[model samples]
Target: MRVFIVHAHHEPTSFNHAMTSEAVAVLTGAGHEVMVSDLYAMGFDPVSDRRNFVTVTDSEKLNQQSEEAYASAHQGYAPDLQAEMDKLAWCDILIFQFPIWWLGFPAILKGWVDRVFAVGRAYGGGRWFDSGVFAGKRAMCSMTVGGPAPVYTDSGVYGSIGSILHPIHRGIFGFTGFTVIEPFVVYDPKRLGDEERLACLARYSERLLVLDSAPTIENPNTADYEGFVLKSVQDKHRGLD
Candidate 1:
């Protein structure tokens, strides 16, 4: 399988790096192709603006969608962004590797999405949800959080882990037509003992190999929605009709 890992942590010796390193070794050892974009090492620009594209749609004003569509048609994206887009297109499975911060992705990782997932490229026109540009591909978040697992449960002060990552799973991966896999979460790795940390790494190795059979989060079909709202018949089952 072709795997593309977007790695976000700044420190090379971090647990996040260990996860990515383990992934590369295991995957490559299995004869799978693996590519990693070390964002901090590469000094990736996270800002989304005209800098994203080499072509201009409107010199007087900035309309990201309009500009992106034009860029998509003319091959006008900046070299860096275009390269990332190429990797997105090349991968069969996409893995976002990062430590969760403030219940979400680190700024650099979030910026990668902002800049790379452009209109007419990632999504635009009628391409979204199940019909999205990358419909058959799969994407997953392999993340580390500073808190205990129980803290992210439904009853915890912080919301459930599912709820916290909903935007990324549904809005980003699902919306772009990539099947969303259940996230591989390592909780408070910094607090874990050496053996425990190694166990987590071993678990991650197993998870990566079985990704095709890995549990996936279900997403509502685009066909069930009209104007992005589910029809009454569909909602009725949930008592939301």
Candidate 2:
């Protein structure tokens, strides 16, 4: 299977980078085609701008839908956006590697998403929403955390990591129509002994080798929500209808 591995950490020697490298080695050794996108190395610009918008004949008067449709039809994506879109199109599976910074992705990585997954490409457009570009694709996130696993557990300091990642797992990937997979996380890197780190490295390698074998989580977008009646009539028919 073709795989796209995106690494978001800036520090080359960071544990996150090491884990990414390990995953790449394992996947490549298994004869899987892997594409690596190191956000920092590429100096990717994450900010969205006016150029992203599709200008209708009279864009000023166009409603949001009209403007969006025009943008989608015109295909005015930036060169960087086009490049990432091409890579995304070529891959069957996507693996994201990053360190948890303040409980989320680093700025550069977030920028990669903001820039690459633009309107028409990731979302927005008439039929595109109903049939998202990423539909049927598989995605997983492998993250490193400075905090201990105990702290992220139910009885621990920070609720479950799964709960913390609901936005990304459900709101983002699910919203885009990709089948989300259980994330792989490494916790308490600062305190891990050499032996523990070695064990984690081995586990990471094993996980990468079997990544394609794991069944993808069903796309949440496939569920029928048309039966539920919203309290407000205007809001009732809104969203994925």
Candidate 3:
């Protein structure tokens, strides 16, 4: 598989960095082509604005989607953004590796998505959900969390981690047409012993080797919906609604 990892951690020595590094090594050793965008190391800009494009669709007013559509047709993305877009297009599998901040992805990674996943390029013109631009590709999040698993459970303070990540899984990955793999979460890595960390890394390596066959989160099929709602109770029961 052609894998692209977008890593978003400021500290080089952090566990998030270690996961990305390990993935590259493991995937490459197994004969997979790999590319990494180390956002922090690259000094990536997280803010989105006119800086995202080389051409202006409307200088009088800033309309992001309008500019993105124009840029998509003309190849007018700023060099940095275009580079990231190219990598995104080239990869069969996309991975976002970072530390979960608060209840979501790091600001840098979120910004990367804002600037990189643009209209016409990533999604637009009725191309979304299962019919999205990246429909055939796969995406997964690999994150290190500050809290333990128990704390993120249904009865815990944070509620279900699945619910917490619904926006990322359903809204971002699924909506963009990528098959969503269940996230790889490392809980409270700072409190883990060296042996435990090694074990976690080994598990991550195992997951990568079987990525092609990994179980994925279910996404709603456009056919199952009537406009935006489910066509029937049966479809909803099947989780497609």
Q: What is the C-alpha RMSD of each candidate to the true structure, in Å?
A: 3.7, 3.9, 4.5
Sort by TM-score, best first: 1, 3, 2
lDDT of each: 0.93, 0.74, 0.91
Tens-digit per-residue lDDT, 110-190, candidate 3: 999999999988888877778888998999989899998999999999998788889888888888789999889999999
Top model by TM-score, which number? Answer: 1
Given candidate 2, what's the lDDT at residue 239? 48
Per-model TM values vs. the true structure:
0.94, 0.83, 0.93
Regarding lDDT, does 2 or 3 come out ahead?
A: 3
The list of candidate 2 runs beyond 4 A from truth reads 51-69, 125-131, 215-219, 225-241
**Tens digit per residue, CA lDDT, model 1, 82-154:** 9999999999999999999998899999999999999989998878888899999999999999999989999
What residue pairs clash in candidate 1, if any at all? none
Candidate number of the best lDDT: 1
Q: For residues 57-174, what per-residue lDDT tens digits would candidate 2 score against the true structure?
A: 4645635444444555787555676788889889988888988888877888777776666556677543231256787688898998888888998888778888787777776676
What lDDT is obtained when candidate 1 is compared to the true structure?
Answer: 0.93
TM-score of 1: 0.94
